[model samples]
Target: MIDNLIQGVFNGVSTGAVLLLAALGLAIVFGLMGVINMAHGELMMFGAYTTFVVQNIFKSLGEPWSDFYIFAALIAAFIFTAAIGFLLEKGVIRFLYGRPLETLLATWGVSLIMQQFVRSVNWVILAGLLVFSILYFGGVWALQRRPNWDAIKNWAIAVLLPLTLAIAGSMGVFMAQIYKIAVTKPWFGAQNVDVTAPKWLRGGLAIGTLQFPYVRLFIIVLTIACVIGIYLFLEKSPWGLRIRAVMQNRQMSACLGIPTKTVDALTFSIGSGLAGIAGCAVSFLGSVGPNTGQNYIVDTFMVVVVGGVGKLIGSIAAALAIGTTSYLVGSGTFTNIFAGIKPLVDFFTFFATTSMAKVLLFVLIVAFLQYKPAGMFPQKGRSVEL
Candidate 1:
């Protein structure tokens, strides 16, 4: 009985760790920018796929290099997703600032587009080229709009820039396709790839009668490291200071000459990059798939909401609570507690036969919100104002 209880707790903690990892990104992005990005899940998917790509690259080199691929992939996922996130913010999200409904719809569309692009290797290359083209054209337009450029120079810039962009974009796509045909086809064989845990992550650590999986332990450690890193970045770094300043008062921050738009773009990229890291972590536990990230998106939103938007401590506490509750309830430990009351036991047993645990969890969350609508740690600032 004690072992079961201990195991349950371990399971809950592991679940909470993942939730914290996934939710932290949303907390930062939504907390600072007030933009509910429905596409955050897709960014995570990109990270998982990035891991697969890196692993395959290393595999092609030789088995000797495979072990270290995950480390390289983690960095790759962050930078790749961050770059894409930066472009996403610059292209689409910037225009929808302060408009919640439009932002929601637009990001949802972006999510769909990203998912489709990730559905196949061919699509991924094509999407990259498309994005490159868009950014290229957008830059030209911005340069054209600049007041410094005279008419002839502007015309020359416009003509030369588009031609250069077209050639560059076409060359990039052609090279990507060639690599995909020559390398990826023989190596990966398919878009759906399996990412196995390293040998070191297998097996378990035994403490008396209870054993914990190393993969879960790695996840817990990674989450703690991320939490500490984010805390320091937010509290000690200059970028963090700007984010906080903007979060406190966007208008006031802008009045003081802080570039709010640039801040927004950076913040979004950081948040998206964090999600990418989480996705890379997830690949250690399971297969990377097109919809890999969608599985956790709802629970992530719940953690952010129940914890209170933008509150790091609140997110941590809420994730633990929810993760533990879900695990215990799913494990049927609560059945013993309800055994003393026959009617309640019977009722719960009836519901427990299916997904009643999740239903009960939702009811509790709804009740929690009813009592404290602002969440466990509500932000007090004009930035959160809609």
Candidate 2:
């Protein structure tokens, strides 16, 4: 009984840690702007795949120190995810802000596109060129933010035009390499990838009567560390202050010369990067499927909603509650305790079945929300509304 109890609690904490990682990013973006980023899960998927790529690279090299590849994977996931988020904000999200339904729909569409992209590399060359064009001309547009058309045109011709052409030439060379791969590489077709955790993390830590998996412990520790780092970044750093200022009042922040637009883009990128980190952590938990993000997306959102939007402490508490209760209930701990009551035991068993657990969990959350719609820790100001 004691061992089971210990294991169950550990299970809950571990599960809650994953939920916290996944929700933290959503909390940052949703809490600040009231934008429901339906695509946040896909960003997590990007991180998982990034880790997958790193693992494969290390395997191909036949490196004995492959365990260290996770470091590279973590860095790559953060950078790639952050860059993608920045581009998405600039190209799509910025236009749809303040419109919750529209933003959600648009982000959902973006998520679908991203999923399809991983299954195909045939369009890489075209995508590369398009990216180059955007980067080159986008700078000119940024310079033209003040709307000096003649000056903008002159700058485009004198500077951006030549730079664009040079980049185009470089892209041509890059495309040739990609063309060769497209013609010859049979593995470029749509297929799912898998990631295997390093050998060092393959075991467990045993304590007198209880045992805990190292990977799960790594996840729990990593999550706590990340939460602390984010707290410092948001509360202690200048950029953090700028982000909070913009979130508190965008118009006022801009008036005070806080560069609200840039802050929005950076904050979005940071949030997206956090999701990427979650994805990398998830790679060790199970198979890195294309739809892995789909598994946790709803639950993480529930964490955000139940915890209270934009409230960090709320997210933590909700994650712990949801994570612990869901595990205890699904693990049949209560069912065993009530063994004498056949009907009650059967009822618990029914929901503990894999498919129904989520359904039952969601039903409970919906019921909870019916009474406290603003969540457990409701924000005090503009953050509570659209």
Give me the candidate number with maximum lDDT.
2
Instruction: For model 2, state the Cα shift of residue 6 in Å.
Output: 2.1
Model 2: lDDT of residue 174? 72
Number of backbone-clashing residue pairs for each candidate, in the order shown:
0, 0
Q: Any residue pairs clashing in model 1, and if so which?
A: none
Off by over 4 Å in 1: 61-64, 123-135, 138-192, 336-355, 381-386
Give a tens-digit lDDT track for model 2, residues 1-386.
Answer: 66777788898889989889889888989977778888888999899988998888888877685877888998999899999999989988899888999999999999888876666544544555586678776876677677677766775668776777677667756766767655334332355566777888778999987889988998899899989999999999999999888877888888999987798899889989989989999888787766778888888999999999878899999998888888878888757766789999999888875567777888999999999998999878763454
- In model 1, what is the error at residue 8, expressed in angstroms? 1.4
Worst 10 residues of 1 by lDDT: 182-191
- The digit string of per-residue lDDT tens for model 1 on 119-169 reads 544544555566657676666767778676575665766676677667666
Clashes of 1: 0
TM-score of the candidate numbered 1?
0.84
Residues forming the 10-long window of minimal summed lDDT in candidate 2: 183-192
